[model samples]
Target: MREISLAEMPGLLGQEVGVSDWITVDQTMIDLFADATQDHQFIHVDPVRAAESPFGGTIAHGFLTLSLLSAMNFESIPKIREQTVGINYGFDRIRFVSPVRSGSRVRGRFTLADCRFRGAGMLMTTYDVAVEIENERKPALTASWITIVQFDPKDRPEGV
Candidate 1:
């Protein structure tokens, strides 16, 4: 991950943070996600059945795409220089805008939306994230994602 000081983060607002390397969502990956989530909708798990549906073939689950944010964020988002830990702070909003067909490749593009000192050596930040399906006109999903970074009091900059 790229490393930047917490003090430098505010300057990055409204700017693209980074783009992640591409990853494929193959049938096996889709199936594994289905099994783990206990969601067996034919559109997601049955290619034969899905072929007859409007999507023309099986598609990845929305949550499966959503789950990719963690991996994508890890690869693309900047890390705070003095942070002792960072946690997923949950999303403010998410929308599945397009289907990710089996075997499709996807990548994330991130923009820093906002950042603020929450309190006591804690920082809260938001990212505007988009999951783009390779060669597709529309993105697979978009979200406003939040994260919290914590630093030891000693590591925090003066007055923060």
Candidate 2:
């Protein structure tokens, strides 16, 4: 991942931050996610059944796609220097626009939508993220994801 000084964060507002490397969503990965999440939905875990459905074959669960953001971020997004920890704050909005078929390659494109001081030593960052399905016209999902990053108090600027 790219590392940038915390001081440079404010300058990144509304900028396209990064694009992650492609990851293939195969049946094995889909089945494991279903099992872990206890979803066991046919469209996600049953290829034969899913093949006859509207998607034409097994598709990854929407949440599974959503859950990949952190991995994708680690692969390409810029990190703040001296940030000790980052926590998933939540999503302001999320939309599943297209199905990610099994064996499909997907990648995340992130934009630094907003940033704000949360407390004395924390910064809340929001990203506009799009999960693009390889060779597909429509993206699989789009979300406004937030993360709270903790930096050393000594690195924090004085005042707001």
Candidate 3:
């Protein structure tokens, strides 16, 4: 996990940073997410119903995919740098291209899209993230997310 500063603009743009985990999209995991988010649609939680549905099996929730973005900060990418804080700015674009059925392997691919000055000890960086399902031609999800990762020595974000 190589970490750098936001002031290190343009240089990191388009760079493909490798995340640390090899995640499995299991049925138990999907069910857990369903329970947590109150999204227990049959397609995601009921094996019998989902088996009869078009998907042929239980699938992960789209929000579950979106939720993985926040999980990435802790699970996959480590803020190995000495930065004081990293804050979520927002999303530039987000799309759930394909279904992530239970019993699959997925990994995140990150491409730095834009990094610009956001003033007063902050830099806004846009990253294109793809959740690739193992052995699948199409990705499970695609998103462009923004983060203002700060290397400020004076103060840290309130929550951090």
lDDT of 3 by residue, 131-159 (tens): 88889999988998898866664432332
Instruction: Report lDDT (Cα) of residue 88, candidate 3.
Output: 90
State the lDDT of candidate 2 residue by residue for 13-129, as single tens digits: 989999999999999999999999999999999889999999999999999999888899998998778799999999999999999999999999999999888777899999999
Models sorted by lDDT, best on top: 1, 2, 3
Candidate scoring better on lDDT of 1 and 3? 1
With candidate 3 superimposed using the best TM-score fit, by how many Å does residue 46's alpha carbon deviate from the native? 0.3
Local distance difference test values of all predictions, in order: 0.92, 0.92, 0.75
Clashes of each: 0, 0, 0
My TM-score estimates for the predictions, one after another, are 0.96, 0.96, 0.86
List candidate 2 segments past 4 Å from native.
158-160
State how far residue 152 of model 1 sits from its true place (Å): 1.0
Q: Candidate 1 versus the native: TM-score?
A: 0.96
Those runs of model 1 whose alpha carbons end farther than 4 Å from true positions after fitting are none
Off by over 4 Å in 3: 6-9, 75-82, 153-160
